[model samples]
Target: MIKRIIRNTGLLCLLFLTIAVSQTSAQESSNLKEGKVSYITGENIYVRFASTDQIENGDTLFIRDENGLAPALLVDNKSSISCLCSKLGEHTFKLDDIVFGRTVKPVSEVVQLQQELPEKDVNEQVLITQEPTKESSRTQDINGRLSMSSYSNFSDEADNIHRFRYTLSAKASNLSGSKISAETYVSFTHKLNQWDVVQENLNNALKVYSLALKYDINESATVWAGRKINPRIANVGAIDGLQFEYKFKNMFAGIVGGSRPDYQDYGYNFDLFEYGAYVGQSKKTENGFVQSSLAFFEQRNTGNVDRRFIYMQHTNSAIKNLTLFSSLELDLYKLENDKPTNTVSLTSLYFSARYRFSKRLSVFGSYDNRKNVIYYETFRNYADEILQQASRQGVRARINYRPVNGFIVGASAGTRFRAEDPRPTKTLSGFATWTKVPTLNASLSITANLMQTSYLDGQVYGARLSKDLVSGKLYTMLHYRWVDFQYVNTLTNLQQHIGELDLSWQFSKKLYLSANYEATFQEQQLFNRLYLNLRIKF
Candidate 1:
């Protein structure tokens, strides 16, 4: 297995090198153009061009910032004079940043219609061809963040616990004007004072969240290797091997071949080989946009068929002020008598929608009929097992209303039903927030929750206050909550109180620090926790 992996990796590298050389040769023989950033919005940046006739939808654009040229935008929608772009990286920009578009193909390849034109038409054509030309250059942007956190916990029955965690995330792309790119996110945690119980679970203290490399063969097709999650098919989770995708107009198709991570600790293993394929389409309408995808996957455990399923997802915003999303998974393979059999069964379903009635009012709702995820290796007790096995069919709805400026009120309700369970669980919650207090530089919020189930009923009340001390540099928050629970069968009641304080400081544009302290009191016992984190971005 290791030899095969190495061989595959080598082959992919050679293929990418070949493509990069070819592209470089072609680019040297062609010309390029430039555009200028004209406007910026919360979700998109608009670029103005002399004439956007050469710009394509999937083309990439680089923005010149203080850190040099960075390929930080992707062109999504365009018109003859302007193009809409979405940011691909975190880069702050002001007005009139120089935007460099892709290299233009050779003019000889462009088709021309030769004819005897009128005298007036020839003059207009010559004027149109006299516009200024710009040169295209390659971009290399390396940026990411590093964070370290320390956590300490104190309890009555157990010894004081302390842990330190460090996380690193970075991306280096288009290095030296090549299409090669690599990204990784990894974290590790260590216990300051190891205890027997803690040591038993130390195997999970290190995790490699993602490590992937991508090679863009061209504007319309790309390939990726290693463990990475594809945004278009996020429901399928991470793929551990290779993925290839191609785009056409408003549609895309892709294939994935990989091995699933080990079941015990999410590490590498050859027994869980899997493969899948998906196709999707997206389009923008007069009102909004919509996208949908369908995928089929198969998995094996030690050369034996383990699971096969089909997944479907859809998202829509074509209706004014309304957004909708839904996804479904259906099992296509079942096991009987230690043999695989064909069957059709709905495994999971989820749907969510939101609508804005006006500038001051909005509502959102969601429904899910998926079983709760269960990890047998991590189960601690019978109650945990029971909760994992319980069917997680539930529906929730929330609404927010702003009666006046700087003040908002919201309410939510939810219910969950389990199969063969006579009693269902229901909950209701409400909150009110005042962003700008009359005489103070602080915001305040109050919330209440009521919950009922077959075994227990509870009520919780909470309040929080937050203030900005130094405009955008420093902030502080304080919160308190009270909870009361009543057991139905035993007719017993319990009460608890909790409090927390949080502080954050932004020292510079690329550095931040935060600290949190929390305490809980129940039945004459107390528990406390403290957390501190520091992060730096590049």
Candidate 2:
């Protein structure tokens, strides 16, 4: 049965890919339209229109202010009703500034207008191609996803267990142009035949990922209330109070005041008040761009200082075909002799760089020296505690080559070491992908990895076949993997096999459904999982 399923999946992949490739040219047209700048916060400008369905990342829009059309703005991201834009050059803009998408006027009309206008005013007339107009009808933009999953485990020595989980994420904005936006995410999980435990752990099962409202006070400033995560200072995680940001040319500054979530269950905790401020600068160089930010945070518990730290992050793409990113966290407060003292200590550091030698070749490397993440409430086992104490300091390097169109080969190596350990864990991997298989219109990838650790060694190999069934409407993928592990001290060996199948269907422009099934086998043990998700966009 498994073989039959695999064969059928392969046939479908090839058939779908063939149709998608043949219809690619017909889907190249766009329906983008003009939008107006509703508000601006720091370098992030919010442009709103009737619908953002046709807008896409990297699209350019001309911005017009009192001084007429200024520089263009690049659409960095978009939601259902708004597009987040960044300035492409040194152009000053204000609130309610007009923005226009691409529009073409008839050559004959342009010539007539120019001929009738004075030479001095010809340029001004030429600039009046199109202006952004506000939509008469106000509509609230809403989008979200709901997902459910089930897991079952089978073992010879232990009774079978089953678990169910559900997750929800939603975002709503505009709400009749009141300039209000809110987003939220929550999840719940429970084991089968464990109603009592589920009731007892209800609080832990439900987590409010984000519940935030954003309001634009003016052109250059905005405030967010409630829990929100800011990408500018994402290393600080989520903030539970207020966030304010302002922009000045190529520089930006922001401040956040909030309380950290409860460490135990990720719930609201008023006693863990925290506040921070950050400054960042960004500029485009001749070849690329550079951005950097620095922030300082202070956290207090019960009105007493609990932690103080400084974070710095920087990214540079100023060199052609190359990118560099680095960040560091330093603790400013430490406890000594049961007394708090100001002492600087590096807590975490990461650096990464990627360089594309050419269209067909690229290399990337990274180094990370950070302590392992630990959840105090969940650290019940000795292994978990030991792993927390073992700092995960590692370095990885990878290279990829594409000798021909739709074909790629890559290799990578990495190692992790701890100060207390004598030997480091090393890993090596290689992979190949062929999107164009001669006359077959399908994609296939194979990957293999070998790992050597102080206590054990392992090898893993996998393959995947995937294709888009109906252009952007439907997709399918099948994957299989084999793993072998050998314990160095115990002289024990184990092998496992895993297989997965995934399917996604875009029922319409606003609705989507996806499902996944996975199974694993190891000797007499078996594990299975099923997942389904539904998403909607407005």
What is the clash count for each candidate, in the order shown?
0, 0
Residue pairs with backbone overlap in model 2:
none
Encode model 2's per-residue lDDT on 3-84: one tens digit a residue. Answer: 3563354335334433433332211113335455644332235565445566555455664322133335656455444555
How well does candidate 2 match the true structure, expressed as C-alpha RMSD? 15.8
Candidate of highest lDDT: 1
Deviation in angstroms for 114 in model 2?
A: 37
Reference-based lDDT, each prediction: 0.63, 0.61
In the order shown, the candidates' Cα RMSDs to the true structure are: 13.8, 15.8
* Candidate 2 to truth, TM: 0.70
- Clashes, model 2: 0
- Residue 221's lDDT within candidate 1 is 75
Q: What's the TM-score of each model vs. the native?
A: 0.72, 0.70
The per-residue C-alpha lDDT of model 1 at residue 146 equals 71
Error of 1 at 303 (Å): 1.3
